[model samples]
Target: MAMTSLPSLPLLPLLLFAIAANVALGATIVKTLPGFEGELPFTLETGYVSVDDSELFYYFIESQSNPKEDPIMLWYSGGPGCSAFNGLIFEIGPLAFNITDYEGGVPSLQYYPYSWSKSTSILFVDAPVGTGFSYSKTQAGWYTSDTKSAWQTYQFLRKWLIEHPQYLKLQLFIGVDSYSGISGSIVVQNIVEGNEAGVVPRLNLKGYILGCPRIDATINDNSKLIFSHRIGLVSDDIYEAAKKYCNGSYDDVTTSEPKCYEAIKVYDRLIKDINKYDTLEPKCTWASPNQEEDMSRRALEETSSDDFILSPPKIPDMWCHNFNYAMSYWWANDRSVQEALGVRLGIVDNWERCNKSLQYTLDVSSVLDYHKNLSKMGLQVLVYNGDHDLTIPCTGTQKWVKALNLTIVNDWRPWIVDGQIAGYTIKYSESGYRLTYASVLGAGHSPQEYKRRVCYEMFNRFIHYYPI
Candidate 1:
């Protein structure tokens, strides 16, 4: 029932920094989380790292595994716009929102047993200037591209390390999911380049971790047809016709391919019935017209206005699948939660799970080359995809990895959890660099959320440099 609150810090105006440079180094130690019981078991530090005119926010959790010697991972959630908190509460963080008990009112919070923090320290960061509680002091700082964003994130980590020098010796890894796979590699490249250039307070860089990374739009887009056919969503005739008419390249469709277009139309109509993220996950029944205006604050104010349906779970076990996300909208937006997080008052008017306001520019087309460069650098890499995910099909990731042509250290084999096959894995090596490719069987876009226990088993082994 007891909680600790960060002291109120006045908002820094546009020119406020001219008065104090250390003002940007704002940080607060959280002893208790909003819906959590008792004191936090792990050290929770919420703070900002000033980068040029942008102030990036981050949540730091000390390792439950072995803080002294265990590795620390810097996480960037995908979406190119989704907040790192999504990665925290929904996937790898220590606590998850208890959306299952909600008939109405606040969503409760509970400790998650399968958090990656159990194996290593984790830093959930809000990057690219306009994500989560991160904000830009200057107008020009608000707009960013892939390359520019990586630079900013790199600088943010460097400064954060400089402030927390005790963590300088811990092995570091850049981790992310979804679209971040594109930028995550670039961020790692930036760190690798910085370390090579002899940057001060050097990082003990190890490797990177990716979850259903969206590296190439064209590659992933084309893989869907293949994925759909392989998963039995489309019949053999439909698959063959698409391959025959489209010439196996579905990345870009020609206006002349009428039969290809017809086949795609049929595919779209059929696939619409299933949840695109995971074919097995049930589709949300959209809120009815009469209940449209009668929605929760999370639904009305913070839930993304994207076309996807935002409904409470119909089944008990699936209650928190996406509904727990609604709690984020409510919790983060609450003035009390903001104060607990040490918000800069008026500096952040509101927080979106994924900031829809970012003027993000996706300039870097593909990170395949970035991965290629890292592959030669002798770093350890882990790339895992949910086999059921349609967003960035495993086939697309396989497409790029096969292109790398690394020697197979371990042939593809079924990975077991509790003595039962959970998914599949293959190991590749070249010039001391080792890469592991894993398929999270039957899971969705974010396997960490869909199958936490199995993912934790896989993560524990990977972080410890053991076989999964």
Candidate 2:
């Protein structure tokens, strides 16, 4: 891998301006990290790609298998504000925090065996100019919306590919989880349009993969009632009352008719304490009042850390699934950890896992139109969800997929792993486009966090064009 010069392409003017502006744009081959031992087993490159006044950070990991020929995936986490660590460390990346051994100081690091990078390269990005180590040079850059984030991601990918031309010929795929589904669709559509317009360094855009996707706000908001009833969280009578009174509109129950409002009020009270991300998981209370206040503002369910506690309780009192999220907060904030990852000092004051204070606007309410257009482009797609996820219910995903009206290539059936039923799946196709939908049985919001091994197997098969 050379850090020599940009290829003689149409990117000269932008490249010249980037060089003159003293932009932080270079990749560091991080042989070691603060918590990991000795040297990394895999090739780890950390760097920043300049997008206007925003310097978006990314961690690029080569595949453990055939790196030269394997597919490359650009992964984005949800929250419209959550860090990409939500994808890298927690979901599918190889390195993860050693949560059980943590007592104080920097959290220890351990390798995750079922990382998606085992079969494909992944660029886990801290995007939209305020998440993770990514920061904006100007105050205006701090303000971003759904459309702006999507275009910026396209800009970052173009600039990144110009720097590392080796991956330019490999198949490129956009992989997103949770709320990123909105922007991820836009990014893919943008790439397709760029290629059509003869853009420089044309991306090898094959398709995209989405997990527990948040497609339409109204659909996702309304499906919670169905999910709750199916999972036995709400009684049949209560569910029926809300369904009849609400009359299919469930986004804001308070603003509806009196009977509808009352029905939703009772519905809310029944499941108020349940973790929306995973109904089976206990809702851990946030440690501080400020953190609680922060959580309250995320009414749109844009965040992926709905079940996290600011301060992790004693592991002995009761084990928590979200303690790993807390451990990451302490680990990322450490100075040594920052230095190890080549983070520019003084640019960011605090490193939050999900910074709700960002000046973000939800401009794009629904991206089903993008999907409809992409379906005509003849691209391969995989849309999956966790059966237990309520935040972005699988039922909502099913409704949108059904709306596409693609031919059923494969009927609904159970997919197996280790001779056991992992989940159910169905396949759809229109023209040359293929979309396969699956559910990770009993998994939560982000299925990889709840069922790592099962997800890795499913991903490996999908990327290789094998049956899942």
lDDT of candidate 2 vs native?
0.82
The lDDT per prediction is 0.78, 0.82
Stretches of candidate 1 above 4 Å error?
Answer: 1-25, 285-320
Q: What's the TM-score of each model vs. the native?
A: 0.88, 0.91
Which candidate comes out best when scored by TM-score?
Answer: 2
Estimate candidate 1's alpha-carbon lDDT, on a 0 to 1 scale: 0.78
388 Cα displacement, candidate 2 (Å): 1.0
Error of 1 at 193 (Å): 1.4
State how far residue 42 of model 2 sits from its true place (Å).
0.4
Candidate 2 C-alpha lDDT tens digits along 99-123? 7667688888988889899999999
